[model samples]
Target chain A: MDLFYLAISSTFVNNILLAQYLGHCPFLGVSKRIGTALGMAAAIIFVTILSAIFTWSTFTYVLRPYGLEFLQTLTFILIIASLVQLVEIILKKKSKALYNALGVYLALITTNCAVMGVALLITRKELGFIEMLVFAIASSVGYALALLLFAGHRERLQISAIPKSMQGTAIALVTAGIMSLAFIGFRGMAA
Target chain B: MSKTQHIGATLKAGLWQRIPPFRLVLGLCPSLAITTSAENGLGMGLALAFVVTLSNGIISSLRNVIPGKVRIASYIVIIATLVSIVEIVMKAFFFPLSEQLGIYIPLIVVNCIVLGRAEGFASKNPPLISMADGISIGVGYTLSLTLIGSIRELLGSGSWFGLRVFGESFEPLAFLILAPGAFITIGILLGLQNLFSRWRGEKFIQS
Candidate 1:
């Protein structure tokens, strides 16, 4: 029940993208098409889970013991950057189609603040190992939900008569703002 | 390209031509998130400027030795190292500001603006020119963030930087402080920028 609540709240109420506003770059950039949005979401999920596990272990095992907790940011980023590279290589050799689809998105995920945000949130929230895993999965799912929904809206927006200046990024941003307002409805439910 | 002209152009490009957030749109994460207040925006911008300048200088100097295949990974390591220095110094000295900034202080490592400039501009240029580009772009980004924060803060709180610029009768728009307001404000700003540019072009042609 606790894990279920965590997952639900993280997915909607405290959504990483909408509420916390962790990964807006990819949320806006990649959400133009459902296919690309889904691909980026998958990549985010994969990298978030992997990076969380790695960061958790590194923080608990190495940094804490040596009183080098200050190095958490630097260490986690380096780990994430290299880990993405390793994932890219392994994916290329193991599965061509999967690699081709997720290939470009993987590189971008290296700097996707959501990935680092999860690591920081896990520590800040003081969650256990299981909770950390659940949070990572839920956050990624939340990101996917927002991305797919925005992509659907944007597809309709392609035809809608928007103002001359508000056509591309401006309209998309307004749509996101409305979507964020709608997500506010999820608030207080967790309480 | 003429070397002298190229150097001069690259130096000025960071201001408007190659603006980090508006033009390249590379570093919107920190640009939008930390700009809720002018002070926070300045703090974040300065921290980023320091990081970008140092990393660009180092990366440019070491560009020859870093292999092409591992360049991105190498750049991350270099940037993460510099970000650590900033994080430690901030925590040790300015504890309150560091706490307020929260994870964002450390999250600077993954800010694509810094890494993007390093990889795109610094690696191919001389150290002096790369440093200039980094600082100029950093200033441009800082100015943009400060502007966003001031606009949001003023409308959201009926105050500028917490000074209560508006009179007691003023009612602040609660939405501006919320997530939606950030999006709307930036979106409108971008649209206005485009509109102005288009209008200017037409005027120039008419004359």
Candidate 2:
């Protein structure tokens, strides 16, 4: 029951994009096409989960035992960048379709702060290993949910007759604003 | 491009042409994350300015020595080192602000703006010119972030920098401070910017 609440709260109440705003760069940038949006969402989900696991292990076993918590940011970034590279290489060799779908988004995952934010939030919240995994999964799901919804809106936006000055990013941003306002409805749920 | 023109153009480009956050839209991570308040935004901007200028200078100075295949990795290492320095210094001197900004201060290492500048501008220019470019772009980013921060802060709190600007009548829109507020505020600001630029273009044509 507690785990269920955690999942729900993370998905909507404390949404990674709508609530915390951890990953707006990709949220706005890659949501133009549904295919690429889904691809990016999957990439973020994979990277966030793995990053949280690795960061939790490293923080608990390596950094804490040695009193090197200060190295958190640097070490996490190095790990994430290398991990993205490894994932890209493995996907390319093993699954051509997946590789083609993910394509440039795999490289982009390295810089997506949402992945790092999850790791940090998990540690800061002091979740155990299992709880950390749950949180990671939920956060990524939330990210994907927001990305796909935005992509849908953007697809329609491409055909709509928006004002000349509000075309492109300007209009997309305003639509995001409306989406964000809609997300506010989730705040009433029990966290 | 001619040498003199190249230097002059590069310096000018960072100010508006390649404005880090607004024009290039390269570094949205920090732009959205840390601009929750004017103070946080200023602190982040200053720290980023320092890192960008120093890293750009060093990268430009050592561009020839770095191997092409491994340049990105090398650049990350250098940036990580500088970010570590800023992180430590901030923690030591400005504990309160440091605590408020949280993991974001160190996360600056991964900020695409700094890396983007290194790869796009710094790597190609001389040290002095690259440093100027870095500073100009940094200023542009700082200006944009501060602008966003002030707008959010003012609307969210009915105060500018915590001084109540609007009297008791103003019931600060709670959405401006919330997560959705960031998107709405930035979106409107972007739209207004586009509108102004178009208006300016029309004026130039008429004149």
Candidate 3:
């Protein structure tokens, strides 16, 4: 019951993108086409989970034992940056089709705060290993869901007649605003 | 161009021509997340400015020494170090604001503006000019965040920087400070910016 609630809450009510505001860069940047949005979502999910696992262990085994909690920001970023590179190189050699799909976004993930944000959030919430895994998957799914929905809107928006000044990002932001308002309705569900 | 003239152009560019959040559209996360109040916005902006300015200077000075193949890795290390310093300082001194800002303080490690300026401007320029560019962009970013924060606070809570701007009878919109309000505020602000620039015949920023 607890895990179910955690999943549902993170996926909807306390959405990492909508409510918590962790990864607005990609939410706005790559949500233009559903195809690219799908790709970015897959990449984020993959990298975020892997990085979370690594960062969690590093913090538990290294940072905590040594009382170097303050060094977490520096350490986690370095880990994520290098981890993305490693994954990219490994994917290129082993899985050609997968590489083609997620290749571009993998590089961009190094800077995407969602991965780092999840890692930090796990530590801050002091979730156990099992709970941490569940939270990571749930949060990435939330991010993916939001991106796909926004992309669908953006695709139709391409055909609509918006004001010249409010055409691109401005209009997209307004749409996101409305979507966020709708998401707020989920607050009651989680509670 | 002469050295001083070049520096002036860089400063001008950072301040208005290519400001981070507004013109460049970089660093959207922090701009959107912490700008619920003027104080938080200014605090976040200043924290970022300090990191970016110092990182730019350090990266500029070591540009030649860092290998091209691994310059990004090197830059991340430099930036991460500076951000760690900021995180520690904020915890030590500005505890309340630090708590309010929360994970964002550490998440600065991944903020594109810091790394963007490092890769784009600092690596190519001399240390002094890079520092000036950092300062200009910092001020520009600070001003933008403060502006957005003020708008949100004044309308949402009928206050600005924690002081009541509107009287007790004033019913705050309450929406302007929430998540949706942030998106709409930035969206409308972006539209207005484009409208003004179009009137002046300036190029439209795609982001």
Best by lDDT: 3
Residue B160 shift from truth in candidate 2, angstroms: 1.6
Q: How accurate locally is residue A121 in candidate 1, as Cα lDDT from 0 to 100?
A: 86
Q: For model 3, how does the per-residue alpha-carbon lDDT over B35-145 read when each residue is reduced to its tens digit?
A: 999999999999988988899999999999999999999999998898889988999999999999999999998898998999999999999999999998998899999
* DockQ-based class of model 1: medium
Candidate 2 lDDT, tens digit per residue, B6-25?
77787677665666566677
Better of 2 and 3 by DockQ: 3
Better of 1 and 3 by lDDT: 3
lDDT of 1 by residue, A1-191 (tens): 99999999999998888778788788878888888998998999999999999999888889888998877877888888889989999999999999998969999998899999999989888788999999999998998889899999988998899878777887787788899899989887783
Q: What lDDT is reached at residue B39 by model 3?
A: 100
lDDT of all the models against the reference?
A: 0.84, 0.84, 0.92
Best by TM-score: 3
Task: Write out the backbone clash pairs for model 2.
Answer: none
Off by over 4 Å in 1: B1-8, B202-207
Tell how far residue A21 is off in model 3, in angstroms.
1.3
lDDT of 3 at B163: 88
Model 1: per-residue Cα lDDT over B18-113, one tens digit each: 766766667777766767777777778889989998899999999999999889888988988888899889889988778878888888888889
Model 3 C-alpha lDDT per residue in residues A1-191, reported as the tens digit of each score: 99999999989998899888888888888998999999999999999999999999999999999999989998999999999999999999999999999968999999999899999999999999999999999999999999999999999999999989898889998999999999999999885
Fnat for each model: 0.72, 0.57, 0.83
